[model samples]
Target: MHKFGVWAPKAQKMSLCWREQVLAMNGPNHRGWWTLEVQEATCGDRYAFLLDDDSTPYPDPRSLRQPEGVHGLSEIYSHGGFEWHDQLWRGSPKTGAIIYELHIGTFSTEGTFDGAIPHLKYLADLGITHVEVMPVAAWAGKQGWGYDSVSLFATHEHYGGPDGFKRFVDACHATGLSVILDVVYNHFGPVGNYTGKFGPYLNENRKTPWGDAVNLDQEGSDEVRRFFVDNAIMWLKDYHCDGLRFDAVHAFLDLSAVHFMEQLSTEVERLGATVGKEFYLIAESDLNDPRVVRPREANGYGMDAQWSDDFHHALIAVLYSPKEGESGYYSDFGTIADLHKSLKHAYVYDGQYSGHRKRRHGRPTDGLSAHHFIHFDQNHDQVGNRGWGERFEHLVGTDAAKLSIGIVLLAPYTPMLFMGEEWASSTPFLYFADHEDEEMRRLVAEGRKNEFAAFGFGGDVPNPEHEKTFLDSKLKWDEQEEGNHGDFLAWTKALIKLRRSHVCFNDGDTHHLHVFSDERARTLVMEREEARVVVNFGDQPFAFALLEGEQLELASRAEVSVREGYLDVPPMTLAVLLSTSEQFENRQVEARARA
Candidate 1:
């Protein structure tokens, strides 16, 4: 016998469309749950929910399988079928994790989960402890950015189904790498979205640029809230994912006592404790709200970490050499002081500013750990949102790439790397979508241009539906062995190694972190414990007085030197200063022994 269930509170009558036979589902069950058991219905059967005797069936909101397109029938999938591996995998700790974010579609030549398997060991060996993947939830189209995913419960059919995802996770755990899946719960994609027909899934009152805000706090929201919360848990427990990257928590319009994010975080944490594994939830919130990552005991929405966009903007405002109109947000960050404040505190705009939105933005993150902030130089959104979709390596030279990498990795906050960012791949990660709907595709293409026009971003915005747009974003792995890429790769490796070896660099302590900046000279120094990271952004060489017996641990380039209480820093370089203490020598010996 097969058990089937769905949430359709508004439906007076519901039927299961399975294998040319329709079976009626038992009514609302006092909690809006429709369930029925059938002896004939079995796993692998293509089924959907027929509401109010309508001939058209909508895909289940909690479907695990959508083998046919999102608009087609959902298939009954059986989990726990894949051969087990990584039985010893207990998950790596959250603090001091080096995360690498990559899109499965663009990361490999095959553009599938299995296609990404071979690269896991490469990242593991590269000192990456965590791999945060872009959304793989089932969405309409052969290719997409995955933010527009509608079927939150189902894995993207094009990029390997549930079984393939299992293999990928198993492979990652076996390779000593933890996997974090990025999930979008704020809004569903425009195309093939039929959730509204079944019930109140989209809210008309709450507005966003993407679409209607998910009816998280509206009436009859319990089921909608459960849908998303369950989706996150499913990824962690069912798929063996280590953590979840919540995409845009600020977009979730929830006024409930326990917000959707709060509830989700609580459940995930409970599961982690129950399973005796470390599960984390990182949010991509632009609100700069410290409450997102604050402890729940302090009456805050508990999350493990949040992406520090302020750090990216501060770095890009100066080093992003191709200073075009794409500097819409960078307008708020243009001084050495901004970079210093961003590193010292969590957000640059901590409840200050009026230029961007003509209003004060962001709260101060005073008590959060450095691990609560994830810093990065390049990411999927930052790169792909541009008209040309150029990376930091393309904007600034490779030398600047090394400098930026050092700044991000050495900072007290957790560091994340974008795919191919280590070796400076030549491919551009352009914004691309493959919606078959002509009108929807045209609107997206036109809307993208209009969105950037306000920011003065110029150039021909490529048609998102075009196959070339997606094809062009594919990483050229062969380029790693090429000219400048190889040198940059080695530089990245050395920096990561040093970060792993040094306790001060990798520690999660944020209270002791301090920063000093020279606005005129365009140099910044971040001192943590016994070590300091000094960066030079000036055209002319900049130097600072170092402590006696201070040794150079790492430098982005060879031009940086430490001599006689003077640290000579060259243009566009980074220097890590560490005193040659007995403790330092012992740690270095241990690091070399491990290496």
Candidate 2:
């Protein structure tokens, strides 16, 4: 026997379009729910819902499998059938964990879940503790960044569907790495969204840059909120994902006593306890609100961490100033002082006026652990949103890129690397999608051009509709073994190794960390327990005074040197030095005694 159900409050009548037979569903009861059981229903049965004499069928809002795409019929797939071997997998510790973010489509040539399995060991060898996969929810396209997902529960069919994703997660756990899935709950895609026909799934009165805002505080929002909360639980409990990175939390507008984020956080914590595993929730917010990562008991949103764009802006602006007209947010950066503040405070605009925003922004993040901020020089947005979608290494030479990576990896904040960033992949991760509608495709291409024009980038924006755009974004895995790419890969490995091995690098205490910088000299120094990071961003080499018994642990470039009680940091280079004060004192005594 198979049981089928749906929440259609407005439906006077409902019918299930199962393969060939149309079965009448029960009712729109008090809570706007309908249920029915078909003894003949079995696994792999394709079905959809017809409401109120509307012959057109709509995919399930909580579909577990959309084999024919978002607009197609949902298939019956049992999650319990997959044999998982991760019961023994106690997740990796959060402290000092390195996250590697990748789009499954572009990460491998085949662009499927099974195709990515071979690379698990490679990332583990590179010292990455967590593998963050981009959104996999079914969207209205052949290929996309997966941000405009329509079915929040169904895995994209092109990426090997639900069972495929389960296998990927299972492989990740077995490989000694954790999986963090990116989820979008702020808004649904512009096409193939039929939730509104069933209930108030969106707040049309309010708007977001993407489209209508999700219904969080409006009428009939209780079920909407529960819908999202249940989705989070499904990923954690059913799919076995270790964590979730909520995209654009700042866009979620809710005025309830307990914000949507707070409620979600509370439920996730409860679910984690019940599942017998620790789960993490990371938010991507432009608000720079400390309340997002603050504890729930303290009346905050209670996210475990948030992406820190301040660090990326500061590092990029200081190292290789953004191109003219391309300085949208980077206009607020471009100073060594900004970089210093990012290192010490994790937010450069904390309670300060932002010229870019034309107002004061971002409250201070005092008393928060450094790990609460995830820092990176490049990410999907930073790279894919550009005019030509140039990677950091492409804009700046090898030296500056290496120095920036060195700083991010060694900083107290948790570090994340975009796919192919470690090896300096030459491919550009341009925005690309395969929307079937001709008008939608045209609008996307036009929108991209307008965005670049606003940024003062003068050039034809790459057409996101073209298959070449998507193909070019795929990583050239073979190039990683070539000359400069090979060297950069080795450098990245060493930095990660040092980070994992050193207590100072892993410590999340921001109070214990100290930063010093010279705006004129274009230099910065970060001092931690028993270690110091010296960086020179100027056109000329910088000489910094060395402490007694200080020795170089690692250097981003070969030009870094220590001699005559001074550490020579060449332009666009960073060096980590260990302090052996005890050894220095003993050597001083021996020299004095011999004298």
TM-score per candidate: 0.96, 0.97
Tens-place lDDT per residue, model 2, 138-194, is 999888999999999899999999889999999999999999999999999988888
Question: Least accurate stretch of 10 residues (summed lDDT) in model 2?
Answer: 579-588
Query: Candidate 2: where is the Cα deviation over 4 Å?
Result: 581-595
Q: How many clashes does each candidate structure show, in the order listed?
A: 0, 0
Clashing pairs in 1: none
Model 1 clashes, total count: 0
Q: Point out the worst 10-residue segment of candidate 1 by lDDT.
A: 320-329
Task: Report how far residue 24 has shifted in candidate 2, in Å.
Answer: 2.0
